[model samples]
Target: MNEIPLEHVHVAPDDGVEDDPAPAVFVLHGRGADEEDLLPVAAELPDDHHVISLRAPDRLQDGYTWYELDLSAGGLESSQPDADDFRRSLDLIVGSVEAAVDAHGLDADRIGLLGFSQGAITSLSLLLEDPDRYAWVVALHGYLAESHADLDPDGIGGKPVFVGAGAGDRVIPQSRTEAAIDHLEALDADVTSGSFPGGHGIGPQELDAVVEFVASRTA
Candidate 1:
């Protein structure tokens, strides 16, 4: 499998990387943001971990989108890309995570994912579909794809998942966020949700919550 090509930035501990397998986090950017966008968020994370931020497959006119969206209905509509292309992207991400873990000699069980907006949606879909691939998931301002209802979390077990949403998010509706939370909890995920005072973006309080969630699960 091909590695997920990530435009990355790394932050190391004062003691430097150890010989042991280090934990890692794969950061996915939102639509219209390249790999560089969310990589900065890694600074808020533990320095002991290797961090990766990946670009979506296709470029939009100004930014990028994971898969094409159909707006014929006057609003965003989900459309599945060609099966092969979608699967290939997923495989690439999985391979990249796997390779990074092996390269760092880090334990596979400690790998995690953090995504914002469109990236968050992608991470949730990947986790729901693949099962047991991540130690935890940080989905910020995102949704569970309608396709996710087909998943059975029995295969993935009880991996912790944290979601941060905004009461005034125009991109991803709050109602939709609630629906996704319901679905995930139904599938038996150890899920936590926090809504903050903001719009389609993150605020200080929300960021703190996310930091706490990641630290709690990974530590």
Candidate 2:
């Protein structure tokens, strides 16, 4: 398959990169953020692992976005650009995974994903599209796509998912959060989630939780 031509930033450990296969995590930034924006958080992960931060396929102002949205419906709604962008985004992720596996011999069982906002939605959507491909997922301030329900649900059982939500988030509706949680649960994912004090942002507390979850999965 021809993978999407998306630019990305990668962080890898100094030692054993060529000699051993390590766990790999793909980090995704929110809308209006570049691949470099999420590098700090990716640094918090285990140093023995490979961290890949990807730039979105399309530019949105000075930064980039995986998808676009339309809030004209009084709430955020998926625009056609959003869905089309996702198809390309998912292809990028899959292609990256293939390259990682081939080049570094990274374990398929240890590959995971982490995303914030639009990135989060992209990560989750990719998992739903190919549930068996990713070992775990971390979604921050994201919602499920309407088409997610139409996908087959058999492959997601026992997959770990961590969702970090802002308790006071007015940017994303509570219903969307609830629906994502409920849908993941219905799909038999081992979902772990908590609400932080901020809105549409990640704090130290949420970061700690995310680290814990990633640790559990990576270890």
Shift of residue 70 alpha carbon in model 2, Å? 4.2
The ten-residue window of minimal lDDT in model 2 covers 72-81
Best by TM-score: 2
Clash number for each model = 4, 0
Those runs of model 1 whose alpha carbons end farther than 4 Å from true positions after fitting are 1-7, 10-14, 17-19, 72-74, 77-86
Candidate 2 residue runs with Cα over 4 Å from true position: 1-4, 14-19, 70-73, 77-81
Give TM per candidate.
Answer: 0.87, 0.90
Model 2, residue 192: distance off in Å is 0.4
Q: For residues 1-219, could you state the per-residue lDDT of candidate 1 as single tens digits? A: 433354344443437556366777888888788877875576687777777676777778776667665444466533333445456666667777776665555568777899888778878888997767788999988877655667785555577988888988888877767777888888888899988888887788888888889888877
Best by lDDT: 2
RMSD to truth, every model: 2.7, 2.6
Q: How would you encode candidate 2's per-residue C-alpha lDDT over 1-219 as one tens digit per residue? A: 434246788787667444366778888898899999988888887777788787887798999988777544454533323556667777877887777666656677778899998888888888888878888999998888765656756688889999878888777755577778888888788999888888888899999999999988876
Instruction: Check candidate 2 and list the clashing pairs.
Output: none
